[model samples]
Target chain A: MTETSISLQDIVLHFPKQRNIFGIISDFFRKKIRRFTALSGVNLHIKQGEVVGIIGRNGSGKSTLLRVISGIYPPDEGMVHAAGDISLLAGLGTGFSPHQTGRENALLYGSILGHSEEEMLSKLDEIIEFSELGSFIDEPLRTYSAGMKARLGLAVASAIKPNILLIDEVLGVGDPNFREKSKNKILAMVKGASTVVIVSHSFGLMTDVCDRVVLLDRGKIIAEGDPQTSIKAYYDLEE
Target chain B: MGQNGPTTPVLRQIGVKSNPLLAPINTLKEVRSNRFLVRNLIRRDVRGRYRNAALGYAWTVIEPALLASVYWFLFIMLSGNPDEMYAVWVLLGVIVWGSFSKSLNAATNSLTGNVRTMHLVFFPRSIFPVSGVGANIVVTMMSCLIILPLLYIYELPITIHLVWIPIGVLLAGFMALGFGMMMAPLNCVQRDVQHLIRFITRAGFFVSPVMWTAEMAMERGAWGEAALWNPMVLPITMVRHALEGKSVELPDSIVISSLVVSFLIYVVGTMIFSKYERGAVKYL
Candidate 1:
């Protein structure tokens, strides 16, 4: 039997409507809830070293699917199984406090990603070198520009080699040179024997890096197969 | 996709378990596994609190000291000095109340404050409240050091009962943590919960023996017995009794019952938090 790195069976997710105090109290007393489904009847599986790309329009549940696979959001109905440690680079500079120095934020982010302080400290030099923040690493994150923040985020996230790496639109970061460096970093990660699931809007990047691509629309998979075919199908649907 | 090659077991499950008993254990296990994260969070919180302050760490001591002095002046002016030891009594109450309120306030807002981090990664959401409690505990210890000299200056008689202070602090911490855990998740869902907690804690100071003595309540007969149910009463009274070298006025039954209630609150809080933890991010 081929070792499966990640699998999902008929996964579904729903979110309740945002409410004020009055709404919550009423909902509590009425014993009823209204929710909007984000995903439905989603089934997927990845082999140990497969690199899959998920392409979808805005609010099409691409991020939600990654969250479910990473065990952040519980599916309303369905089963999800992911083996090994998974790292999610969802948003820019997650777990980073503006008041904290870059070094401290890196340590904090590393801990949030499940690395011990000592482990992070040992990787500190490499992370700093990779991000190329140089002397500014000691400065508070508030001092960094937008691209600088994204570099630190990417640097800390990529420092540790995760068994499963889930990327959500992080490729659209930094200026040209830094973007090239980050893309290379991602390519190197994909070269390893690790399962990767990436969500992005960049069709060229998806087709270039992903072995396969899945096209999603309105919370359901519409087409999935070779990157070239899926990308074309996605554009055809858009047209 | 239909070629199920010996269906592999999924690493994590999405649905909630029916067994309520297992919830607390699972929550504890999650928190324990993330102890490093919790420690770093606590460190960040404590440092963050005093980050830009000119006085820095001294603010931990100065704030409580200033508060105690203000209460001392107000109470002495209103009711006249009760005894030579009134300052010590007031300082003790201030320390106890400060720890409890600081912890509750921090923990109540913990989830809301860390909403960004919660969305970006997955850890035990309980860690926010738990680390809030830890940060307060560290600050409380620093404040207690300031009070130690006052006790010595007053030449308060030392006794074996002094040991009860730590126990009291510990019980108070657990009670605050329980309340925090219960409120943290709710606060994420409803912004009103934090406001409500603030109101309750503000009103709690008057209801509990923070500025008054338990003897004042004991004089109320049956009302006094009802007052002991507040949970803070026992610990506050214990710390006062320990420092004053007085006999424990709270009966054994009452103490045991209070301990059991605090424990139950903690367990119930964990269960409630775990129940809503996954949903909390959505609300955030």
Candidate 2:
């Protein structure tokens, strides 16, 4: 068989738009809440080893599309096909549980990321040493400073070496030095990892990392093809 | 959609996704039941608690032991039955009930407790109940070590019937585990169940014949028989009788009914849980 990979067809995803809290308690209780459509008729496909950038605004369904593509959420209506174990880190530490220690959470989170226990163990040292937390690895994660936790989370997941990696604004967390390291590690993986989908509002990073760019707006793909053209379309539209 | 409980039927409405690492193990793949994966989840469930606790796991025994003291004090002292073998009776019930109930109570909310993990992890979510049950049973066995010594000090004669304790324990585990697996899926769908089961579990504690014996229920008339209907009472009674070497046969109706009920619950609960399992992750 040919090395075909991920595919998405006419995907529609809706999420509760309104925050369901009673600001005006006396007005109504158990009222219906509004929904915000995140993705509407989104059709895309990525071949094995293709590096794709998904560019959209905050509410433009960019992250939602990535999450759906990551197999985190089944589209409300659509067909999706992804071949190979997909690993996704939606946020800096989205998968880590606060109650668990860094050492244990690594295995727990690593397993979910699709690594077996032996796979995680063999890479555990690199993960910890990269995080540079040293003895703090034993501390309960809730106690870790936000930055420390981010380092730990990023290190463990990067060590996983996923086949298809979905990264969503992960480099937004740390300082310049850490961001450089993060970008280097990610770029290195691009050669080995079969497919990668990165979502960022920053056109610069999109240009730097992705082979092709797809611009999304209000849940629909408005323009897709060249990195520069999509960037021009995104900025010109904003203008 | 669910009828009586939270079950998300995974209807393959469309095409298969390409995930080489985690293709749904349709019939068991090359993996040899990663012993470490199993150990990590279970170890996390166990050491996760004891790691930061001041009392450590000793609280496992101290917990039921403390409850035993209060019950024995109330029954033997206040009830003016100091001569009665109530302490050992309470200890025995505490031991067996401690094992299964700790697991059941933990398992009941295992899904809710690990909502984050469940949403993220792809390994069988059933591992939560299994791990919780396993962890509680370990602690229960440890408490039994304390209870066994106490049993000797109380001069209770050991007998062959105690060999059946493991069987009864296993049955009790099934009963609790079945209920737990069913509740896990339900907790995922309904947000309120976590709070609701708290009072219900407390009520369950009193009616379970844990602190007191079923014999005293006689004065309560039909209420006494009604108490036996509580599914938790039967396994403990069987195990308690077996452990005490009390020559007694359980009523045929109860034995047949409970085993069947436990079996149905176990099978149907697992079915329901797996059904909704995927949907929960989707919604989350």
Candidate 3:
């Protein structure tokens, strides 16, 4: 068996209840503000090269779990151990400035992912080719459509091959042709001994690509099994 | 933390560090390790800011130049007799004060400005504020270039005392970084904190030693001594003194205490930011 790539033990996280200024002031005089739990007592283990899918309704902590595993959010009560470099793909085109050219924004985004400019330059041809942006890469990002921007974001993000890739709802980007191409790239990564964790509402893709699926509800894991079983459980829960 | 290889298991705990006393030291280490990210961010900020502007980077020099000239004119008109060095003095003060206030306000807004990026990836959240200070410092140094021409126009000589200028700039930068780090987290939670900071920095201009020197303040006796405790006084005064090629005239006790206080504030600010930053992100 492959070694465990990600190990979480009883993770718990809470977001402070947001309040207006008046509510906060009144609470200061009367009581402490309350908190809403995002994740509570979540434990999961994934071995190397596994493709794990997380499915849940909105507000069900699907995205929160990915963040916890990637070390974005510090769990309030648990220990998280993961092997190798982790890259999170959430909200593509984040940090992209519309004023910069696609090439410039690509360089900036690469740096955000810990790659140097030289490294990004080396991968520039592949990024532009994969993004299908062609000569348009020289133009300022303000000229790109939303789809073009997301394509550029995905191309740059995928340029660096990470040990663990956590994708959050970004796979459903671009035209169907590009989506298929990106999916193939991810499958190639898994074949190359990388772990993949994806959070998405697209069940058909989840069932087709995932090795295992986990269903979450109200911040707790409710079911875990092969893709078909867990997805069925999710559908039943919704009903 | 990043890993070396796939085989090396990286154990990352998802909560604040257990020891608060070592938090600042650890935060410094984290920031140091991510220096590349900081550098790239600084470049982006510097380049993006000027890319669309008509004057481009020239605005960096023109802004302080215009503000300094207006103040210099007002002072000359008010005092009746013109001090030959007063133009250079006001120029230096305006440049340093511009950097200090921008650093403070930028630091406060740093995290909020980068909230989208902050969530997509994790490095050191402190990098946002650190890079904010850095970008402002780069612009301020560029702004200082305008002062060189004024020195020649005013017919002043460069002296060894001018070495104190960078020191003063850095001291002001460090103090602003500390206060801004503390305010960044608070500003993330309650946006009112930002408006309050804006007001304070605006009021700060009149209270700080920008228009007047510490020598003038010391002449007022105890009130001046107490005013010297404002933390901004020493650095602003240091720059103004260096430009005038005069030795700093503040009491040794006050100087030492203010220096120590700035350092302490930095330490406290780092600790507070590390502790509360995660919580603050939720608010954003």
Highest-lDDT candidate? 3
Ten-residue region with minimum lDDT total, candidate 3 chain B:
B1-10
* lDDT pick, better of 1 and 3: 3
Q: How well does candidate 3 score on lDDT at residue B111?
A: 86
Regions more than 4 Å wrong, model 1 = A21-32, B1-18, B157-163, B245-249
lDDT of 1 by residue, A1-239 (tens): 35788889999888877456677677788898766789989999888778899998898899989988877787878898877777787786776777788898888888988787777988899999988899999998889999988999888888877777888887768999999999898878766526789898888888888889998888999998999999888889889
- What is the Å distance of residue A136 in model 2 from its true position? 4.6
lDDT of 1 by residue, B1-284 (tens): 11223444345553334355566677678778888888778777787888878999898888877887898899888988577666666777788887898888888898888877776677667788888888888877777677577668868787888788877877888888888888887787788888988888888888888777777777889987778777888888898888777655787777888888889988988777777767776777
lDDT by residue (B119-233, candidate 3, tens digit) is 7887778888888999989988888777688668767678998778888888898888999988898888788888988899889998887777676677898897788888888
Local error of candidate 2 at A55, Å?
1.9
- Best of the two (1, 2) by DockQ: 1
Off by over 4 Å in 2: A15-36, A92-102, A135-144, A172-175, A237-239, B1-35, B82-84, B95-105, B118-123, B156-170, B214-223, B245-249, B277-284
Task: Give per-residue CA lDDT, model 2, range B1-284, as digits (tens).
Answer: 11112222222223233342232232023223544555565666676667767899887778877887888887765677654567766876777776766677777777767766544434556666776776776666666666477557767678877666666667777777777777776665564555666666667777787876666654478888777766666767776676567643556776677778888777766666666555454434
Per-residue lDDT over A73-143 for candidate 3, one digit per residue giving the tens place of the 0 to 100 score: 88889888887778888888788877788988888788787776567888899999989998899999999
RMSD of each: 3.8, 7.3, 2.5
DockQ, each predicted model: 0.46, 0.27, 0.52
Pairs in clash, predicted candidate 3: none
Error of 1 at B259 (Å): 1.1
User: Chain B alone, TM-score of each model?
Assistant: 0.88, 0.79, 0.91
